[model samples]
Target: MTSLPADDIASPTSTWDLVPATVLSTTETDGPDRPEPRPACEDVRPVIAGHRLIGACADGPRAAQLMFVSDAEGRLARAAEDGSVEPGCTLEELAGDLARSTGRQLHPENPGLRRVLLVRLDAPELPLLAALSGTGFTAVSRHGWSVVVFDGELDYWAVRTGLDETAVVLSSDGATRSFEVLLAGEDPADVTELDSADAVCVLEWGPPWQPAGGLPAGSGRTPAGQFEQDLVRLCAGGTSELQIESVASVFDLDPAETNRLRNYVGGGSTDLVLESVLQLVGLPVLAAKIAEGRREMADLEDARHYEPTAMGPALLRGMTTEPTGDGLMARYQRAVLRRPELLLALAGTEAALGLGLAGAARRGGSGARVLGTLSAALLADAAAESAYWATVRRARRGSARAVPAGLLRRFFGLPEG
Candidate 1:
């Protein structure tokens, strides 16, 4: 019966931080030396985030669509649509598909990933061990949970989903309560039973875990004393909201109950954009975080170089070829914006590597063998960094936000002064 106060609630994350705002046309309009968005000699991995599914956001979705992923272990994200898992199906791909499933023309103002129904098993098993006393621990039954992600804002739905809340009980008298339980979803038996006052707020039997992500599989899960018996059913779903809830609850209460703790960490309001993006805060910490990412990447590369195993080469190839996740090429591309200076260093490094390989190429034996083998992949790492650097250099020379502007200039290209 009560609605959330209109002005008090804001979204938890903002896309504007990662997405670069479109800039006005620059010197490229007239100059003959206009640089290509990518390098001319495309031999290496390009230093840019190559989106796999472009215009996906530009395309609109139906009023709503449903995506069902399994929670089976080792094969956690099996797509239920065809009962088979796509070996390399990524989260972004899933999001994109769900966004386009209805196949409708999108409104120009509201294009891309409005909402999608995510159905999966829950993630409460791991943290449920803390229950002080409960008689039906072994009697819990499996229940499928579903939720819709609207514009990637997690907290908006958090208050309404009851299943995600946690409780502390002196006995069985207590239960974790959600801020509100507006609807209980559609069930025919209950339709005839509801009173006039109850009918206004009740729609369908809104399963407890929708906006909060799916619920954990209970007693009906794998039996005790078996190999898979001990495993807790997890719903680390593909959507941003599900992933955010699951990841944030690593050390605390049942992943379901971790909301209040998260709110505390976010200072009563958790917004990824406010904390990580906007220039209102000091970013010495942000700078360190970007540096840490670079360091971790360096460490992985070092491990691959010295591991002396056949797997190292395969791992390196995966890193370079995979465009998303922790891929090496992805890191290189992201570094282009976060640390453009690294692009200059990488250009020199690649230049030397090309020279070393040049002599090897002329040998025409082992050199040819290398080229015929993994040379394209090998050169891609170099090309990615070098090519991106070229654009940054061109922009700097043209006085594109080259002067003291804002802290963001350190991380992105700004407009002309």
Candidate 2:
């Protein structure tokens, strides 16, 4: 596959900071680490179906019965024969063909956003794929889709690298163990031999190497199993080691954590929840605190939660609040919490940028106007994050605090304080 030159790829502002490692990778630390880079296609089943292949590679399943990476060069034709699989049509054309052949356009299959993808066929290395495959089974899923996301996030098994643009993995029904390529909507695809007397071909995408767009809005927010919900149940039904093991397997409990968990269960103490398990494993409570801090700030920002009477007191201000979750907001807060000095630093940085942009804003050029607008936004971010730190500090504690509502109201004028 011909690599897109740096100049050819359109980059968003967020990506500009990345010091890319390869022609395609988003970061300097990333790139194809697998040998026989022979490009990513030929590394896998060469000549898939009847078309020539390149930069394709496969890994055993992580979440599914048999999983493989359909890299930018890999997405499958799910062929009957194993020679180069070629895409010969758009997704609309192929879907239309299937509609004609099957006598109906199959209803859209929503692979609930809790991505069952266990494999990072998109990983930079092949061997690491096997090693890291078992991970993500218990991770918190963000809209970006990874278990590594901060708490209260949508739980997921793996981060999807390029689901829209390629066959990121071969997912079986887990019951049939039979692989089916279900590419929906419209895009370029390769369905080589549906009409052939003796061949099978199914799958397609808009373009190779170019990941055109993201999953449709609100489409990537669902949880896979009731794991999030089951966490609630697991906490309630802490009766047997069997139940413990079952949840652990779903989460792919870390070996050490798993051992400790068994020891915990064996000790005969019940009443475990997701929070308890996280605590048992020594995963930091800081993650939850950070999430709480962000949620608090979001509440403060929302007009619906505003109480004029509570304006003077910090505690009441928080009481009448109902902040919806914003993972991105949480992400920014998490980063600030990790390196708090950066939050302070953001102020000075924004001030400096604001000074620079003010003159440009006065000049009235479109580029300067854009820069001025972004600078003002940056300033707002710096201010919000600075204020956010106070909430986090108030949230900080070794254990839950209570029993001071009246005292705080009388002395501090903030009952919740």
Candidate 3:
């Protein structure tokens, strides 16, 4: 970590060292009368030292321009532009002229400027210049230009450089505060100060790879493996607070990857499972109804002199009624319990012959699918129970008639009249 004085940060200035030897004059044009000499467009040499130019443009008065240049592999790069250069000249010369014209000086203590202006020369530089505005040193555009303003005072030399999507943060003062610059838009003065600890944590999570020929696969530690191990260890037997914070720490993972990890841990087939069930099944509402019913039953059971004559029918009636516009699962359960005899009749039928109570209760699917299946099963069970009771009624009439064929037909899916 390194600390830079707040005043040390300044915008970049152009160095004219790389200006082409031959200058093209666009103002003067060849004509038949005067026979104006054809202007030579000399090839501009690349800036060799300070930074490499990634882009340029020539538009607007005096041909505004933008350029991108960088230093280290991951270190932020500087973006320089031709803010106010003399007309009709090479970018290199224009950069130098702008720096000299503005009378800006680089601090002796900060020697980050290497006196090379990366020129991305283009015609009509206004489009490029317009794009560069407000793009801080690390501001990168999809067009491949990165804008950087190194010093607030000498903003004239702020450059637009090309970049490779890499960012570097330099820190000092035990990492309490540092500067962050992007390689794509590297400007010496465009550094942003950040807390040291937080920056280090970010660096730790950056892409990791083995040094060339350093070790065989699995022979040495890897960041991904380490991260997974840490996650599992923290989640195992850890308090909710610890687990939550640990999860939050990795929030920077790409959204798609985060969802994949969450689905793996939440015991669901798909990422949509938990939310879907909560919304569709209404489990909380059903549980509340069950609680209420249990309380009601407890009161009735506590009365030792309870009479089935009056109370049983009333209880049965209460159970059979449709859910009164209440929550789905709760109403469903109440309706089923109202007709216990129906369940017993269905339990004797082939549908439930081999299924245990748990298996009989199991309902698959979600939302409408689950509701439809459960409703159908309940209807069949009730029909079976009604048929059984009807047979008993016929026997009590003393006629001992054959089971009502129509009842069997209706309940068993036989042909109907």
Candidate 4:
């Protein structure tokens, strides 16, 4: 078998900086590998009689199947005669002939495949049509009434019929196949010819497919809330691979959520969460900054004794005690007082502003006002700092002056300056 390219084998590293310690170790151990096989398809047949064909693979140890069904007698006859064989047909013939050849009755001498219908359209519709040929039985092309015939087993028919928008798969065996085209506004009875000697047929259709229960309300906040709850639970200590799985499992969150969370973690947002907790606990600015910074980059052992700065101590004291009342605003004020350095950091970095710290401070109270002032100071400080660095950076260029001594020497014809 051909191997996958080396690049395809690679897994992305975790971007989140604050991954649980357990996850870090486990991720290192697990690395990249192929996934395990899914469950096999069992004996499932197309749902005939409702004007649709749906079935599952019976023999294969695979999760999906192929099906072929046709209502058009002329197309069926052409498929059987030309033997040119369509791209996806596994078996094809008139319904009667197909049954006689296979020693099975598709619909017991009805001469027309009544219940089974396969949708057939031009090649351009292949992508949507191919989606139907997957794991389960579902009604497709509901408005089109059609019939289907098959020489292969029901599972094969189910898989093959799924390719209606494209040609059917033809095997090396004498059996030929063609996807039944579901014509617009064409009555099912008008298309069939009773006298055809060879044909295979089955019929099916039913309740329409419903994707997910329904869209969630208010910008889908329900799902987001659920996701947040899952994260909160996972973070509650005793964290393990199981916790990550639990977070991942809720409502089958798609790949996008996984990538988003990874980015949040990678961009040091999780470190901010930890910092938020410290601020809540009344840590002063210097103390919190040192602690938060250490949390961001320092080894675990050094994290405990981080010292609080004067601003940090004052803010923490002000927010946590006496002059403060209790409520949402109060808590926010305290958080602001305790984390002015966070504001400073935010003001200094455009990246932090995008994260919303600056906006949050503008809306806060007296403590928030302090944070706003600190943010301005930080921004100005950053501008000055950048100017200083720019000057330093250009110092060498300025120092490389066109020395008057060299020109003087040249003019005077002196050997040296």
TM-scores for all predictions? 0.22, 0.23, 0.14, 0.13
Relative to the true structure, candidate 2 has a C-alpha RMSD (angstroms) of 23.9
Residue 375's lDDT within candidate 2 is: 72
Report the backbone clash tally of model 3. Answer: 37
lDDT of 2 by residue, 214-303 (tens): 112231122211111222232122235554554455446787777776665444222122224446533433222222222222232211
- Candidate with top lDDT is 2
Whole-model Cα lDDT per candidate? Answer: 0.26, 0.29, 0.28, 0.27
lDDT, candidate 3, at 46: 27
Q: Estimate, for each residue in 1-417, the C-alpha lDDT of model 3 and write its tens digit.
A: 222222222223222111111122234346556544222111121231123222222121111112222222222222223321111223344346434543322121222211111122111121223233322121111122112213232332433333323323322111011222233444433333422222221111111111111112352234322322322232122123333233334334355544443443344223233223222312222211112122222243211111113332322322222222233333333344444455455546634433433254454434545555655665566566665445434434442222122223444454532
What is the C-alpha lDDT profile of model 1 across 369-416, one tens digit per residue?
675344444456567556546555555455221111111233233332
TM-score of predicted structure 2: 0.23
Q: Tens digits of per-residue lDDT for model 4 on 222-311?
A: 322232222233222222333223333432445765444333323322324323322332222222233223322233321211122343
Model 2, which residues run further than 4 Å from truth? Answer: 1-175, 179-337, 355-378, 384-417
Error of 3 at 124 (Å): 11
